[model samples]
Target: MQAWSMTDVGKKRRENQDSTYVKLDHERNMALLMVCDGMGGVNGGAEASRIACEEFARSVWDTLSGKISGKEAVALLEKGVSAANMEVYTSAISDPSYMGMGTTLTAALIVGEDAYVINVGDSRAYHLKRRAKDKLKQITDDHSVAGDLFRKGSITKEQYDTFPDKNIITRAVGTDPQVYGDVFELKLDKGEVLMLCSDGLTNMVPDMAIEQVLKTSETPADACQTLVDMANRAGGKDNISIVVFIKD
Candidate 1:
């Protein structure tokens, strides 16, 4: 597996509230990718994102260090996220300054040809599989108000685009005392790619555009840079973070 990641303070945002981490455990043939988009005013958002990512990564590394099965590793990942959520929530409650601080988390762990995905809030995980010479498929869903409205048939494609609160997430880590994340597993082939990104990239670049770029790019780093460039060209309204992993 090959991994590439980057985070940028977009054209508009004064602070980069997004955080990302990617690590490969060669001995276990496992790779981990995590992205978090924090929410709050001033530096609180960035702090929350940093804390969530660091705690989650530390917990996962510690829990999975022993000889554990793949299923057990997956369970450990969930527990790590839950622990991070509680820590963030408790800290925010104790400190009135970070009262409403929260963050969206999406993580992916790849072992052999199988990948496990877990997500909370609107940050996304996408699986890009080559169907033909020029076709790629995206296998993930956004968890936002606009996504819900679109799913419920209450909003059309145009309405989703024009929705004022499209960035408002219905659920997020640290927002509630306990956070539940959606988990998924995927079987990957040689040419498959897994992308984990904050809403900044998705809100600016459409899924089809992402597929095209991933299909055209020669490497994971190139794909990640191209996506970031495309998002910036499309107004760059928020902080952007992206991680791309390709099966070798």
Candidate 2:
């Protein structure tokens, strides 16, 4: 397996409130990938994303051992999300400046031939088959108002694209006392790629353009850098983050 990740503050953002993580264990045929995008006032956004990402990764690292099963991988990722959410929530309530801080968490755990994915808020995971002509498959659902409206047929595609409150996410990692993440499992075959990214890239670049990059890039690192450049070139209104893993 091979993995690569990148995060950028973008053109307009004052600071980068995005965090990412990637770990690969060849001996065990395992990998972990994560991306987080924070929201709040002052420095709370950055702090929230940093803490949540670290705590979530720590939780998984502490319990993950040799030869994990699909069920076990799911449990570990779920626990990691819970741990991250609690840590962020505690920090938010304890500090006055971070009272309402929250962040999106999208993660994937690859063990053997299966990948277990967990997500909250709007960050996403996508699956692309290297040898097939299939279109990119988004693995997670957005938890924002516009996403919900569009999914439920309450809003047309054109209206969703222009929705003013599209960025307002309904569910997040640390906004509530307790949080749950949506879980999904998929097969990860050789030469296939799985990507985890923040809305920064999605909001700026359309899916078709992103698919083109993933399909043509020579390597995961190149794809990451190219995607970041593309997002920045397209106005870069938000902090951008991307993490990719290829089953080699």
Q: What is the TM-score of each candidate against the true structure?
A: 0.93, 0.97
| Model 1 Cα shift for residue 46 (angstroms) | 0.5
Q: Write the per-residue lDDT of candidate 1 for residues 13-97, one digit (tens) a residue.
A: 9899999999988777788899999998577788788888989988886556545566876797788789879878887888888
Q: Which candidate gets the maximum TM-score versus the true structure? A: 2
Model 1, position 150: C-alpha lDDT score: 92
Model 1 TM-score is 0.93
Local distance difference test, each candidate: 0.85, 0.92
Model 2: colliding residue pairs:
none
Which residue pairs show backbone clashes in model 1? Answer: none
**Predicted structure 2, TM vs. truth:** 0.97
* Model 1 ranges off by over 4 Å: 66-70, 131-138
Write down the worst ten-residue block by lDDT for model 2: 61-70
Model 2, residue 11: displacement in angstroms?
0.6
Model 1, 206: alpha-carbon shift in Å?
1.3
